[model samples]
Target chain A: MLVTKWVHVPEKAINKPRQIEQDGVKFTQSISPWDLPQQFRFLIDAESLTIEWRYLSDSEPVKRKEFPDGFAVELGKTSSRIYKITVSLSALEKSISVMPTDEAEAATSALIKMKNALAEIENYPNENNKVAMTKTAHWWANLPNKAELLANAM
Target chain B: MLRTSLAVYGWLNWVARGYQRASSYIASSCGFFLLIDTEKSEFLSTRPVITKFVQEIQSNMFILFCLFLFLAVIAHILTKKTSLDVWKEIKFILDRYQEKCFPNNKEKDLHRVTLFRLEKHCLFRRHWSSRNWLNFRGHCRLFSNFLVPVLRSGHINGKSNTFFQVGSDQNYEGVAGLAFRQKSQVAVKNLPDLSSPLMAKVKDRKRLITEYALQTNCKRELIEKWVELGKTVPRSIAATPVEVNGQIWGVLVLDSTSPETLSSESVSDYTVVIAVIGKLLERM
Candidate 1:
């Protein structure tokens, strides 16, 4: 069975510090959240999953990657932004089978609904969609242990 | 107590009588009474010497009362000035918050500005009178399960003045993680137990983890690594969960090298400040 889930990456994960050597002078620079994509679509099958992501501001072609079986796709480090799928490969390899079938399906459905709601808000900026967006943000912010909880559950 | 007071009073009376007799003898020896009229002198002699002594004591008591009153007034003024200064500092912080966080009535980078304002203005800039606390660090960890240092204030290695840094990720450990887990404020005066034996230290560590509801494997080794890297391991730490819309969005943490620099009572201001930041975050 093909299961799909949409993820909204929190801004914290994308904003990371990197050391840059310019003209032999080393300085730490942070990757801005604006420079990274904050949303992704995870396409999961029985043995592998593909992650598709794109920047919000650009009309560029979406980037896609596939991981073998035993790989997991969930929230990124710091419970925030999701930059890529490979970051958590080693950490989540064993937890993929831990999630029950029914719960995984339920979580996928809820995530799909949330993605739709967010899309609606983007398209129509109406009061109802704004309310829905607020609710979604609230729910997302409160799920602090989303990655670990999902890994354990899976 | 009453009997003791009466005894003291009688002793004073005896001393006063002796003083009076000495004064009378001196006056007689000086022959000062020869110049006065006998009748007037007789009247003066009839006056109780104790009355004069009591009068002198009353005058000294009045002088002491005056001094006490002067001190009381000075103390009152000083206290008033201190309170006024605190209020002024709070107002100044609020003003800075408005200017920095919500420039042009909009927040461009909400988290960065919030953490910067708190670190620069509230925690370090306020009347935090401790030299050891001069290196106070303010950091905000935005995730509950895994603490991530999104922004930090104060000096690290005497460089990197900017508040934005992607520091190492931490699990539910230390004061910040404990605060996140507890959903409230958590503060520890001291962190290490270097004086204890190895076995006792292990037991203490376990007890502390259980007591504070922190994750296993105390972050002391990590702190030691930091120390090796020229970073000071905090002696005191306080963390408060930043709640946005009734859900904890993250945690605001402050650490100092001085023990007892932060406590539950001292962190109330921090809580208020974090709460305000949370409300602002909700708007964002």
Candidate 2:
């Protein structure tokens, strides 16, 4: 069965300071819509390998454009913002399906490592000492089982 | 209706009788000898000759009147039928196009243009119209000075009858259909197909879309600022993607609402419609 996963990585690990690249792809934890201060929910389809971005405040969700293969998203200077690198691709595909048994587990582990890296950055008062600190703090805390939730097989 | 028809027929008959009398006088002027034989002068008198001529004249007049009346009625009926058919065709096109443009009941929320210049110019008021160019130029200047900046920068200050001129040389004039972008957001809650099953499964999708669109706008503004050394103020969504020499300068995002009546397929169908709009903009 085709499976999908979402991983969160810290900005420092993937940014110029640490600058880590794996398999021609860079990873980072960006202040994306997924990290908004408000509580949001998403529905995932493992069979089709898709993520449906929905909101609790609103009635419905929208599809985040298919994640770029070689691009990366990292937290911007502002706590409420995210910066994503533009990546060139052959064609626009709806979903990138992977084997559930091996690939899914690896993706989960990668996301957990990124989440831990972000936690270290969040510990430093200087890194987050900005006008939007409270907003960013809540954003980090709401990642429900941040590690385990990366790739739910169902 | 029946009574009126009978009265008209009676009046026509009376007029025909008068015409017969006039014809008889002319026949008599030629002398009674030519009309009757001298031997049977008493039996074939002036009365019988006059009566025959009068009958012939009346019969001809009656036939001609009936033919003219029939033609007039048929012409009137045909004209009415064709006009109604034309109106139906125009209405169908407008309604279908409106659905594609404003699918979410958002059309209802669209405030009417109070500005005289933008109030849906009549077919008669176009440039092709013989109206004075001085008036058109005056309105264009006024719109540029006041409404253009407000709409482009997303500011909402204006009274009733706000107008904006767009395009190089200010060839197009648009009126403020809504008050402000902030208030306009309230109506944007139901964006037709974006909220449908295909999109609804994603969490925080709407927020992401909104933020993404706004961030892109900000980035464009930042680039414009770098070039001009001034806050590259966007005059309006109309000003986005300003083309010069066949190149796209930026992209503009406009807000719309959901009316709930249109099907999801119609929303995706908008790509075709919007593409046509882009082409028209390029031409402009």
Give the alpha carbon lDDT tens digit for every residue of A1-154 in model 2: 3322323333222221112232221211122111222221222244222212111112112222223343333332322122221222222122334433333333333333333434544444223222123333334345455434534523
Top-lDDT structure, candidate number: 1
* Candidate 2 runs further than 4 Å off: A1-154, B1-87, B96-170, B175-284
Q: DockQ for the candidate 2 complex?
A: 0.01
Instruction: Tell me the number of clashing residue pairs for each predicted model.
Output: 5, 21
TM-score of each: 0.27, 0.21
Q: Which stretches of candidate 1 lie over 4 Å from their true place?
A: A1-154, B1-145, B155-171, B193-217
Give interface RMSD for all predictions.
17.2, 18.9
Candidate 1 per-residue lDDT, tens place, A1-154, comes to 4334556655444333344433232222322222334455544555444454433222222233333433323322222222334223232332344354433433444444444434543443122223333343455435656555444533
- lDDT (tens digit, per residue) of candidate 2 on B221-269: 2232222342222211211121112222122223232233332223223
